[model samples]
Target chain A: MIRWLLLLMLAAGPALAVGDPADQLPNPAQEERARVIGRELRCMVCQNQSIEDSDADLARDLRRIVREQVAQGKPDEAVLTFVHERYGDFVLLKPPFKMATALLWGMPAIALLGGALLIRGMRRRQRVAPGPQELTQAERDRLAQLSGRPRE
Target chain B: MSEAAPNPEAAAWRRRALLLAPLAAAGLGGAGFYAMLRGLGTGDYDPRGVPSALIGKAPPDFSLPPLEGTGLPGLSAADLRTGKPMLVNFFASWCVPCVIEHPQLMRLAREGVAIMGIAYKDKPVDSLGFLKQRGTPYARLGVDQPGRVAIDWGLYGVPETYLLDKGGIIRWRMAGPVTEEILAQQVTPLLRRYA
Candidate 1:
């Protein structure tokens, strides 16, 4: 009986999370598309979570807007642009490549190139003087002379 | 790719530079952080401030019904483009920040500034009671019961204020309570610049 109760709870849990069934599109394909778009939108309230993942009221409203746009047969870009026009680039989880975002987009490539150069420099450094060379016989004799110790 | 052995002086210089790199970086970062903290203390920096996209653009189309029992006229987007700059404020009965901002709004209205109010996501009865208690400063009022109109305006939080130019373009926006200092420093300057 307890197992049955637990199973019942597990089934009901996701239904509650799906939230306000009226917001979902009737077409399954459209619903999936709406969800994909939702994942790209930032929740303005939470500042971190995507509208798809956040339970904030603003997130819900954005999700509903995405679904409505999808149901209207709007392309993904058009729907995204509709939101972008209203909320600006901050709403996009992946910021668009523009003069304003050039630095943000270029940083990973810059870091990668820096890392490659660093590794090559280290490799060249390692190869040039393959670690500390064994002291020459003259150097060893000189070291012994300086320290006043007999060479073994 | 020099075949000769590395110069000892050059290698030593590189080693010294590598050692000092982190210290220099830390010093620069610490100075920047200290400046940011000082700005925060002086109310010059707002870490959570999000620049509003609606600035320099007209507001989204909306026409909200007035709250019942208020006897105030409803507000709409058409009412905004009347060749007069005005303030649009979204507040709620339950928002404590709205209460704090109310006095400034009242002061502005006393000086004959056209102020429009939207009761955001609050019940009509609660809004009416709130207005009754505080005395409405609004020249025109609307109730956004379902908050759809708020979403159209890209409103994420309540107690937000917008200043519109004579052309009905949004000139400035303040997201939190409009305290006395903010009224004197920022909003007053923005109003003149747009005017």
Candidate 2:
């Protein structure tokens, strides 16, 4: 019975530790908005983690700022722009399409098209008749000389 | 010869194109790979520095209390527009780099540069104690407890210094500890330019 109780407690432990207590807001609606925004903002310090997932001090501060802005009735884009203006494009998990990032976004499609064209060309080349196994002028001349015939 | 002999010039051109096409693609691919490697190697190039969006913009207003027992007046954004260039430094007792940067601040203070210090995220008592031992270089010191002021200033971390022109527009920002070299080379020249 004690072993079963211990197993049950272990199973429940993960559920208790799932959500971050620091991210809670006074209003549930505002908290949900903050959560959505936080997921979109990258933690500048941690680089790899979103502000929602990072436990870095700067991330916590940013989360508070987001919650405060949301509580103040700022829209989602306004809140994102606030952080974006300060940190540049790097703070956004999804970088906006702009002149600077045009090449970055276009490279994959260009590579794909280029690959397709290359494959098509290769297939076309294979379908072409292995054009006349004709001898070169030197080879013909040598052949004629070796066969004891007059040069043509 | 076969039923139809291929045009020799055209065949030669086709052969050259076939040979050059993959070579050109490989060259491009290699260049792209090299660029990617260089980008990755220089990732987090300015890890300590985040360029402030507030540059050329007026600083946000604030009325922070002074650090206790420092005998220095509290600072406001309006005070920065004194018709002369000034430096605003964000620091804290808890920050190790702030301690390292203290001497450079002292030298600037001694040279008659007007510097305003914001004690970020530190207790008044601790900040006062730290200044007392290390010597306060600020003409005016403000205590930013919750760091709302620092946030408005677009601060990423402690030990960031901003050079503001006479009109209170931020001209330049230096993140991380101010070494003697940076103080001499970048800071002094900009200060003179604005002056």
Candidate 3:
């Protein structure tokens, strides 16, 4: 019975270990920062690949730098700024609010405003247009009588 | 003598239609957003699952400058057919995955696997600097700076390795990091079989 239990436990050990690789890593705080930084930074070697997805040598190096900076207690903005200094703005998908990135930053607001204006315009037209309800009581009664209802 | 009231159901329906216009717009907008995500190639895909054109076909034929520029000779697909199987790795100095896989690559080189390296989309100077620091495991090295050669081989990203047979046809291709287990199970058997 003990032998069977040992075998079962041994088999289950590796299965448990495979669950989440991140859990085995040393620091969760640093790892989380690294992950956040990685998603922001574009992989220089692969076109369209973020650091998180890239397996390139440079991606690994950048990931190491992120972890190191985080472990050293660097602020998120500071770490990002440091990397940006070396890599430039192209490295970030969500570019900073700046002259060159004005379009990207302002797009959502512009869309919202435009939509609001369009809906407002539609509502105004609907309000102004006379419908069947706009008719006077006498007109409604006349129409109803014409349509064979009891005349008032 | 009583006034005729409006058709209550019809009036309610008109109100409901007004309410539903925005809902319909929202549904259409949502579908459009979903299509944009997929159509723009931004959707998620496992890099490892991406198929390589060179997997079953003959690798591209080309020559490159040696590490030392020793002028010994350049490597080509023909070099793969020398009675022993070979491994060709496409890497760049700038790729992080390539760095992670470097130790494994170095071990493979030490094991007399007869590896060929391709420098993809990198400057010659950078490539040389990388090999210098990393220690060259590549029996032969090729430079593909224009990236035309890599595209021809259907390479999506860096750190892709191919195992070619004695006939220069690719037997297997690995798109991501090659672990020790992959080398032991998949690569070793092929190498031994070809040998």
Q: Candidate 1 on B67-183: residue-level lDDT in tens?
A: 779789999999998787889999999999999989998998887778999999898999889889988899889999888888777788889999999899998888888888888
TM-score of the second chain, each candidate in turn, equals: 0.84, 0.77, 0.69
Give the clash total for candidate 1: 0
TM-score of candidate 2 restricted to chain B? 0.77
Residue pairs with clashing backbones, model 2: none
Of 1 and 2, the candidate ahead on lDDT is 1
Docking class of 1: acceptable
lDDT for each residue of candidate 3 in B88-149, tens digit (9 for 90 to 100): 89998898888887888899889888888888878777877887798787887877776656
- Model 3 TM-score is 0.42
Question: Which has the better TM-score: candidate 2, or candidate 3?
Answer: 2
Model 3 stretches astray by more than 4 angstroms: A1-152, B1-48, B68-72
What are the runs in model 1 whose C-alpha is more than 4 Å off? A1-18, A123-152, B1-23, B41-43
Q: What is the lDDT of residue B18 in candidate 3?
A: 100
Query: In model 1, what lDDT does residue A117 have?
Result: 100
User: Candidate 3 chain B: minimum summed lDDT over ten consecutive residues — where?
Assistant: B39-48
Tens-digit lDDT track of model 3 for A1-152? 99999999999765642213442237876787778877898776674877666666556656666777788888989888866654457667677788978988899999999999999997986666655558799888989988998866
Better of 1 and 2 by TM-score: 1
Error of 2 at A57 (Å): 1.9
